[model samples]
Target: MQRIFANRARTPEGWLQDVIVSVEDGQIASIQAGQTPQPQDRRVDILLPSLGNLHSHSFQRAMAGMTEVRAAGKDSFWTWRTLMYRFMEHITPEQYEAIAALVFMEMLEAGYASVGEFHYVHHQPGGTRFETMTELSDRVFAAALKTGIGLTHLPVLYTYGGAGEQPLSGGQTRFGNTVDSFAELVTQARAHASRILPGDARVGIAPHSLRATSPRDLAEALMLKDEAPVHIHISEQPKEVADIQTWLGARPVEWLLNNAPVDTSWCLIHATHMTDKETRDMARSGAVAGLCPITEANLGDGPYNGPTFLAEGGAYGVGSDSNVRIALTEELRTLEYSQRLRDLQRNVMIPGEGSVGAAIYLDAARGGAQALGRQAGHISIGNLADLVALDGADTALCAVEGDQLLDALVFAADDNVVTDVWSAGRHMVRNGRHLEREQIVSSYTRAIRSLIDAI
Candidate 1:
């Protein structure tokens, strides 16, 4: 058992002063405000419930800055993906573990306690299945264990290169798995996941995208998922949407809404090109919109319809998809900024109403936790103690209090403002750096350098 004191702690209801939190067996044992700190209690200035990244491709961290150059003609997501496919070719299982360690550690430093890794690369080179089908997944789980970061491992079932069950092509060869093969992988993955982190690690199913999984195959994959959360990439690219329409007779979201049971258990990533009705229908379905604003902007995908989506009461969360960058606050900042750039107004995430920071922080935490199928997203008693603390002395938060403090932290403060993080009560990050950062980064640098040299 351990105790921590927060001079100010943000709870779901509101902020509390001089609060004491107790942890036992990696869950919050109790929480009460107006309590004197015990001599053994760890004290913090400001604390908040940490958010989980709803989507990530951890290997893409290795290729963060490699694809920014303009193509000879028509630069877009497909062009960017061609480069991504090429890069994934060089990542061995050993390299995947090394890169994912650094990526997860950085997420801890940036105040994300958990990540929903949208993992897809499941084979050896040239479309050959590995002798052990879940080898890459084992590597990723090892990285999560090495870093003490919570893992929601979404082993993606990517069977085709495009809509209509197209054969695997180019770099995508490594990501293919037949539905029967995928079921075995998921079964082994769940058994493997249970051995680590006990109740905290979740293994969800991802059907890559509309292009990668046909409607019939998607339904079959969902059967393998049981009651676990389901996530899928949908409508991130205009061309992809057009292609799905050509094959499925409807837009990506439209087709899914018509064919699948997309309810609260689903997370539709990058529903970026939805029509007004699609947006409203999606919001009403109680599924989360897994918005990755930084990656979308980086890839030139247009902004999501935030106003219409929210007005229709949608659940949404921000992700570091592609992981080109990994800053929790920066994701929230970019999400709101993208909305502002579209609507040409400030505070686009909220209207003339509540605190934007509180709304973004709370909403994302709730939706992300839901999508990850975890008992997280709060500091209440019996909840997993996934928490983050800010540096009170940071100049960016000078004299800020209550929701305004959240405003400064989310919009003004740099990443260093997050001084400590706990994933399921494990203090993996302290003073704005992961405890194993040096070793993790060293391994990552060596692995990336080897890949770069090969290229």
Candidate 2:
């Protein structure tokens, strides 16, 4: 079906007057500008390329607000992690699918057209493997298929509880898998992914983090990169940085840059602490720094050096890492706000020559597509027809034109203005609601109740 999104804004090309986008077989066939809409054409207030969440742990969505209660002492990321571990112990495959379905639904409604799930919840409660190795991953895939969200399934390799080949903590057992085992699991994931969504879904490898995998194991897992994207957690916290130094004699990002072929196929999540050299090197390497600003702030992780990184020509993408809040506007807002707070300046993330909001939004869209290995993030011809339409009539966005619309959408308007979202030309969200929102929310409610009771 061919649809026209008239008077929509296109980045790098100002407001296209009466733009008629033709989508065929889930791909944009052609996009004609300066064309008037016909009677059969569907007109929307505003159209923009949807954003991709480059880093996420779908199951974590269920635990979003559950860890807010303050313990006796100061609550830190480690303390929150303890609660997260306990939460993971009781999740069955059914609960995982339920929680993930709801999470994907929320993501779609939040203007995210695709998600890269950095999945690691692998075995059952204890160290025991399920009958199917890809049980949790299968649930993730099922949820994405049900929600019609583009998925990049990254099966995480979590071998150790901390830096070295440390003994797996009781709560960490389910996530542990040897290098060989992880390779086999990746193969299984690829086969499972091929059965659904074809080229739209990809199976990649995620070496959980520097603390979770050994140097040798990290090296071995990189062998799975045969044309697939590789994502890894790196330097999110000061403690992680200290531990990596103790274990590997180098910081996480520095070590990975020195050791692996860190290229465009790699996305280093949260390189929060880095030397100037590491920042410039990472930017030059063509790898994306997957920034989850809301989650980072919630967890008190240090602010990333956005100004320096961007000045060095680094690429980056945003994600709702913990799904604490799943709005693309919030993510972009928080990302820029964090940079502003850090540098004591305004509009720190945008390049000198472009609009701050447009630059951040477009950089995230492009970097996320590269990170997820998808031909999305743009509304051009031949790209995946994943588009989002904003209610331009909204008071906050009224009179906004060109890059100003993007600015308003990112900083002023909330998710309410995102009236429609289409993934691969399939409308999963309409009138600011996901198609399966009610059903997924009900299932999630039951799952969350059960999990709370179990805990």
Candidate 3:
């Protein structure tokens, strides 16, 4: 058991002062406000319910800066994807595990208590089968174990290369699996996760996208989803939207909403190209819009339909998709900044006149937990202890309290303000660093050197 005495803390009821949070068995046992700090209590200035990164490809953290250089002609998501496929060919299981450990550690240090790793890279190079079917999945679990970050392991089903049953090519060969094989893989992944991961960890399913799987296969995959979270890449690029529309009868979001039972359990990643109606319908559907603002801007993916979605009370969360950058405050800042850039207005994320920082931060926390199917997103009793502590004395945050303090966090502060982080009661980060930072960084440096040399 542990007790955290916070000078200020954000609860579902709103911000409270002099709060003491008790944790037992990885859950918040109780929250007592107006309490004095005891000798045994861990002391913090500002505490928040940390958000989960709802979407990530942990292996891609290794290729962050490699794709920034311009190609022969115009650079787009497609061209970048081709390069990503090539780069992924050189990652061995050990290196993959090493990369994931670094990514997870960085996430914890960035104040993200958990991650929904949309893992798709499955096989050995050249589509050769590894002796162990869940080789890469177990490696991801191992990384999670080492980092002590909450894991929502999403084993993706990448059946085809494109819309209308296109053939698998290049590095995609590693991700291809028949529906039956993918189901078996999910079962094995679940067993491995239960065997190796903490109780709060979950295993979910990701059907790569409409372009990568047929409707029949998608339906079958969803049947295997049970009650777990389901994530899909949808309408990230105009070309993707057009291709999916040309192949299917309607646009990607429209088709999914019309055909699938997309409800609260679904997270539609990048729904950036939706029409107003599609956006409103998606909001009404109770599905989360898994927005990765930095990655969207980096890849030239268009802005999301924030106005219509928010007007309809949509659920949404943020992620460091490609991990080109991994700062929690920056992710929230970039999200609001993208809205401002698109509409040429300030304070656009909030519904009326409240603090946009508090609104986005709380909404993203709740929506991210919903998307990952984790019982978190609040500093309340019985919730998982997914929490972060910030240095209120930081120059960027010292002058404020309540919502304005959150505003300072989103608009002015860097992740360096994060002083401590707990994922399911595991205090993996302390004083702005992961507990095993040196070993993780050394392993990543060696793995990245080999990968670069190979490429």
Candidate 4:
């Protein structure tokens, strides 16, 4: 058993001082406030429940800066995606693993304790399968183990290249899979994760998006879904929404709500474009809106309907989609700022009154844990000990207390203010640095060098 003594810690009931939290076998055993710290206790100034990155494509981290060039015409998400597909085709399995390790390490340092890796790259270039079908998934697990971050491995089932059941072509060929094969892949991934990853690690399914899978394929994929999470991309781009509406005869969110079992177990990634009706209905559906503000901004995806969604009691969580920038504070900051910029108002995330930072931060912690099927979110007993500690001494967080501390974290500080992090009691980060950062970064540098040469 290990103990953490925090001068101030956020609990489910409220903020408490001089808190002592005990961890036994990765689960939080007890939390007592106004307690004396033992000599062996790990100490920190400010402790908060670390947020999970609810969506990611870890392999895309390597291509972050390469996509920023303006295309010949007006650059759009589709054009950015075409370049992404071409870049991914050159990534070998070893390079993919290296890139995942670097991304996971970066996530830990960025105060994201766990990640919902929406893995889609499966086959070799030209749609050829490896002798081991689970090669890429195993690579993800290996990277997770190397980094000691909590893993929710979401194996993506991408059946088609585009809307209307378009056949797989070009770079998308790597992600194609039949329903039966996808089921087997999920099964094998579950077994692989169980064997190697920690007890809290999970295997989930992602049916790519409404555009990538037909109704029949999606239904069959959902049939393969077990008790774990089910995520899907939806309504990120105007073109995507228009295409989905034209092909399916309804908008993406509308069709999913009417067609599938859209519930709390589902995390709809990037429901950015939606009607007023679709927003309210989706909020009422109990599914998490997995927002990736940084990537959305990078790809020119529009802002989500924040006010309407929150008014309807919607749940939302932040993610570093595309792994473009993996800063948790910036993600939350961008989310609130997006709302502010859109509505032309201040402190827009909370419904009535209170700190906007605390509202979004705590809600994201809970929603992210729920989305990844992780028993964490609160600093409470019986939950997994997924936690982060901030340096109160930092200039950005100095002289702040209560909700102001969170406000500073979201609005003022960078990820450098994150001093320590634990994912399910695995203390992989200390003093704002992941323990294995040097080696992981070296491997990634080598991989990226080789990948650049290959491309």
For candidate 2, the lDDT comes to 0.89
For candidate 2, lDDT tens digit of each residue in 1-455? 86756677584566677788888888889888878788887678788999899999888888888889999888899999999998888999999999899989989998999999999989998979999999999999889988999999999999998877787987899999999999999999898889775468888889999899987898899888879999999999888999888888998899999988899999999999898888989999999999999999999997898877888789999999998888889999999999888888898887686788888888999999999998988778899988898898999899878888889988998999988888888888988999888888899999999988988
TM-score per candidate, chains pooled = 0.98, 0.98, 0.99, 0.99
lDDT of 1: 0.90
Error of 2 at 426 (Å): 1.7
- All models, RMSD in angstroms: 1.0, 1.2, 0.7, 0.7
TM-score result, candidate 4 = 0.99
Residue 396 C-alpha lDDT in model 3 = 99
- How many residue pairs clash (N, CA or C atoms closer than 3 angstroms) in each of the candidate models, in the order given? 0, 0, 0, 0
- Per-residue lDDT tens digits for candidate 3, residues 124-147, read 988887899999999999999999
1-455 per-residue lDDT for model 4 (tens digits): 99999999999898999999999999999899999988999999999999999999999999988988888989899899899999999999999999999999999999989999999999999989988999999999999999999999999999998999889999999999999999999999998888889999999899999999999999999987788999999999988889998999999999999999999999999999999999999999999999999999988898999889999999989999998888888999999998889989999999889998899999999999999999999888899999999999999989889999999999999999988999999999998999999999999999999999999
Name the 10 consecutive residues with the lowest summed lDDT in model 4: 64-73
Model 3 poorest ten-residue lDDT run: 347-356
Give the clashing pairs for model 2. Answer: none
Local distance difference test values of all predictions, in order? 0.90, 0.89, 0.95, 0.94
Comparing 2 and 3 on lDDT, the stronger one: 3
